[model samples]
Target: MTASANLWTHTNTEAVDARPLDADASADLVIIGGGFTGCAAALEAARSGASVVLLEAQSVAHGGSGRNVGLVNAGLWLPPEEVVAIMGEAAGPLLIEALGRGPETVFALIRDHGIACEAVQNGTLHLAHAPSGFRDLEERYRQGNRFGAPLQLLDRAETARRTGSERFHGALLDPRAGTVQPRAYCTGLARAAAGLGAAIHEQSPVTRVARSNGAWQVEANGHRVRARRLLVATNAYHAGAEGAYRPQYVAVSYCQFATAPLTAAQRAMVLPGGEGCWDTALVMSSIRTDAAGRLIVGGMGNSEGAAGAIHAGWARRKLKALYPALADLPFEHHWRGRIAMTRDHIPKVVEFAPEAYAVFGYSGRGICPGTVLGTAAARALLGAGAEALPLPVLPAYAERFTTLLGGYYEFGAALSHAAAPRLPV
Candidate 1:
């Protein structure tokens, strides 16, 4: 199915309207791509009194921003100790502390802007798919507490009560995180930015980016936008910049299937507190309930690929394994999105030219990091200096064998999905 089949498109409450670029324009800042990163940057820059022009190849949140599982998770997928070990002492804690507060930033924006997205702050659950998974969570719990994070380690009984399943050995709950209707949040950001005087144009795909006379000139749909600063905030949906540098990373596909709203009796037994969840299996899977009580189940694999049937079968089996009572539920919606994963699984900021930065590679975490990083990139580009950014801006970054690695991921996921559901219950 096409992206039009996405649940978010049909259920989203927030709306934004913009025309394609019709005439030549100049601004203090020009941003490309209209996902969480681009819209958040535009909002921040415009609020700071800068003339910002945001150009989108498609509509706002048309990419992963719209198709995300809507978990406003805190920090990266890696634990605090792993992050510190990989990023070193100084840079590690900076990024960790910044992202640790990512959920707060997201919730604050939703409240301050009165965004109509189904914003839920009841927290999220990281389930242990097996005994080994629970061991990993124990270490994560220790490191998280060391960093002063408010984390709770729930026993198997508690996990079963919370998730309405006995499949997990235990769970780690992060009180700071929750879920939102991602697409609505992105649209609301663009609307809020436009209200603050940021010029946003949809269907204005940038064809070329060139530096002329100490300014960046962006060509899009027969019009030119000249700006003193530029930000390429296209993470996974990057398109059409002929000569400019492109963000490089392996593209991993994730698909989700949602059932029709359950009856009140069914809802009462499953995630009564409305917390989003994901398991610790190597081939990760996610679960959550929307405000209307539809159960969404997602996993790693392309639902639009040649093995699409295999992935769909896995979803059905997965639901049955988790909740036998709901085994007969039919999926009402299904969709997929791509994730840009770096070699180190860390987000990168590449200062490709004099006053331009390309930010991408959020791995599987986008919503919060995109907002935090996009806002910081705008400040730095507006003369806040590199000190404002959470990570150092590199001159350039490249990854070899991206296509091969991406194919490997898809093949592994398909092979695993086709084999078995491996019911832990």
Candidate 2:
């Protein structure tokens, strides 16, 4: 099994290329990390007449943004009530309202920019793995409705009809959500930003960031970028010595497997509506089909870790269990990426200095929230004021026992996968 084989890389239609930065330059905003957030912010800031310089350590969408599940879902993994409780009454509702419009923001960008990312806006289904899961979905359905979301709870019969699998007890559908080729969407944003004179540089990893003489000076690949404002959007892939501050969050590993394009009959029977779905199990799993009719199944746990074989075996069993027709179909691609998960499962914006902000920790829902926050961050950083942001900018924030918590999650996922019932292919 080639651990680095990624479906998105193979099927990506959008492309972006750039040389590493080697000369001194300056801009109104300097963005680090060429993922969804950074690219989105670059596009927004540049379009708004602000000179932008985006420096990426690798190629665009090379991090979690490239390896995302592609589900353009609204809101966080936490329920609306949980988000409200965690964020409190005032800030919570604001965050929820902004995120609820996340899918809208994403799709509009695709439409306006003509990004060829196989954008699908049908909807997404939240499957209930058990009776308890159904209860949880019921609560989520209620909470979502109260927040003016057009959510629909489907019965088991309907769920089976829609998913073509009787494995789920029921499902909650969000009509606003959809799917996309994550890497394509990300690269498309970079391409669009670059076309608008954003000055995107690939392979330009930042070696140091400092406030020199009341201006932010970012050093990358032996080059310097002096800017009045700075935005550090490197979530889980923060590396090297970034002076002043670094993003703090627990790193959770998620892996995915994709089968070869299914036959027309098989594709018709499974997810014909092209709605992405995820289960309600404690160690949740996801299923969706791409434009080429390939089925993708993903779950928690790293595919390159010591328990790699266990995760591989569990994926095989899961594929067989979900769709017996493709029980013998081997996965054509296997890959993994790390997610920046905050303890409260909420994103953070740290204003570490007078005109510098670092945004990160999307928990697992990056597409929608990342777009929302990135756009808002651009607006705020370019004189729109911090009030334009979804969540209030904090002076500072920290998490304790991050390494221990990450290890705990990996151990629990491995144990669960190893204990799953074996099914004959």
Query: lDDT: which candidate is best?
Result: 1
- lDDT tens digits, residue span 78-148, model 1: 89888888889999999989999999999999999999999999999999999999999999999998988
lDDT, candidate 2, residue 108? 99
Error of 2 at 314 (Å): 0.3
Q: List the candidates' TM-scores in order.
A: 0.98, 0.98
| Candidate 2 residue-wise lDDT, 117-210, digit = tens | 9999999999998889999999999999999999999999999888888788999999999999999999999999988889999999899988
lDDT of each candidate versus the true structure: 0.92, 0.92
User: What does the lDDT read for residue 262 in candidate 1?
Assistant: 94
Model 1 bad stretches (over 4 Å): 1-4, 422-425
**Model 1 root-mean-square deviation:** 1.2
User: Distance from true position, residue 387, model 1, in Å?
Assistant: 0.8
**Span of 10 residues, lowest total lDDT, candidate 2:** 416-425
